[model samples]
Target: MKIAVIGTGNVGGALARKWARAGHRVTLGVRNTTEFKGKELLDEKNISVAEIEEAVKKSDVILIAAVPQATADIVKLMGNVSGKVIIDAMNSVRTKPDGFNNSFEALKALATSAEIVKCFNSVGFNVMADTNFNETIADMYTAGTSERAKEVAKQLSIDAGFENCYNFGGDDKVALLEQFALSWINLAMMQGQGREMIFKLIKR
Candidate 1:
């Protein structure tokens, strides 16, 4: 799978590395190719850097880990994303994109032609980096109306070392998924529970 990572921050960097190691072609899309948050990622095999539009054009999937406030601008830079799968890994915790409730909503409105899903936003970068916990791996969650996008996200989650990628629900559950992410943030940061912990589901 060819993936375009639109943020280059901790979350984007970690996933890019994981996907690259998993034999996926990863591209870091940035405003400035000369300098970006995760420039070191270019040194990894199967990972390269390109301008926003170029990266988007070359990849089948785009992972957005950028700041929530820049959602609109990022969408504009992505050009036409028709038939493309977009995985929004951003949360509106501190701030949301102007005129939108969250990144997922903003992307849905701006990139109307793309299949959007919310995933990778419910866990910390460390958890995404290495989902392994003793003998088991962490579980991933996603929510969106596009079954195709959800399937892509689930496979990407598995590629990133997660044990399973559970479907939360349809588009209506997108906000709930973000709230679930907030719960994790509250526990890990506000409650001082640490970021090493992750959420998983068990059944009989």
Candidate 2:
């Protein structure tokens, strides 16, 4: 899949590297192509850099791992996103978009032409880099109204080395998913459990 990653920070950088290493063509979409957060990603095979609009113009999947407050600006630079799958990898627990509850809600309103979903926001970048844990692998979760978008996210999650990407229901569940991410934050940061921990769904 041709993917445009909007942010080059930890989460974005980690996922971009994983996707590129997995053979997916990845474009690091940033304000300045010459200097960005993950410029070293250019050294990786199958990864390149481009300005935001240009990157969005050339990719099939647009992954936004940017700050929640930048969601509106980023969507404006996405050009025409009709039929494009947009995975929102942001959390608004601390800071939200200018006029929306969260980045996902903002994207759903501003980028009406795109299939948007919430994912990759629940775990630390360390886990995203390496999902392996002896006999078990980590699981991912997604929430969105678009089935197509969710499926695309699931595939990308697996490509990034996850055990599974489970559906956490539809659009109504988006906020719930964010809170779920907070559960991880509370345990990892507040409770001193450490960032290396991950979530997994077990079946009987």
Candidate 3:
């Protein structure tokens, strides 16, 4: 699959590397990708990193791994995204209020032509690229209205190294995942995990 990752930061960098290493046609998207400092990463992974619009225009799946605060405006720049599979990998937490906002709303406002799926969310970057838990095994959770989109994401998850991706619910189920991330943060504060641990939906 042709994958375009929108962001050159940690989340985007890590995922892009893994996807490229997994042998998918990966494109790392950034505002000014040529000026990005992480060129060595893409070079090592043999992946192509380019401008946001160019990457999106050439891919089947467009993954948003950019900053939460800038999501709306950035998405606005990538207009007419209809019929594309948009992967929402951003956290829209409002620090002042100590809560969350809706990434879907921002996507909805800007991406009328896209089928949005929320995944790779709720978990940290390391855990995302490496889902090898002990026998208590974990599952990647994904949500999307389009069955095809979610299935595509499930395959991407598998390619990214996850063996089990739970088809938990539909697109609107994103809130539950966002709240789960918040809960993970709270527990991390208590257990000294510092968002380093991952939350997997394992069987009881």
On lDDT, the stronger of 1 and 2 is 1
What range of 10 consecutive residues in model 3 has the weakest lDDT sum? 92-101
RMSD of 3: 2.9
Candidate 1 TM-score versus the reference: 0.99
Candidate 2 residues lying further than 4 Å off, grouped into runs, are none
List all candidate RMSDs to the true structure.
Answer: 0.6, 0.7, 2.9
| lDDT (Cα, tens digit) per residue for candidate 1, span 1-204 | 999999999999999999999999998999999988999898898999999999999999999999999999999999989999999999999999999899899998899999999999999999999899998889999999999999999999999999999999999999999999999999999999999888779999
Residue ranges of candidate 1 with Cα displaced over 4 Å: none
lDDT of 1 at 80: 81
Give residue 53's lDDT in candidate 2 (0 to 100). 93
Better of 2 and 3 by lDDT: 2
Candidates' C-alpha lDDT: 0.96, 0.93, 0.74
Cα deviation of 10, candidate 3, in Å: 1.5
The lDDT ranking, best first, is 1, 2, 3
Instruction: List, residue by residue over 9-68, the lDDT tens digit for candidate 2.
Output: 899999999999999999999998887898888999899999999999899999999999
TM-score for each predicted model, relative to the true structure: 0.99, 0.98, 0.87
Candidate 2 vs 3: which has more TM-score? 2
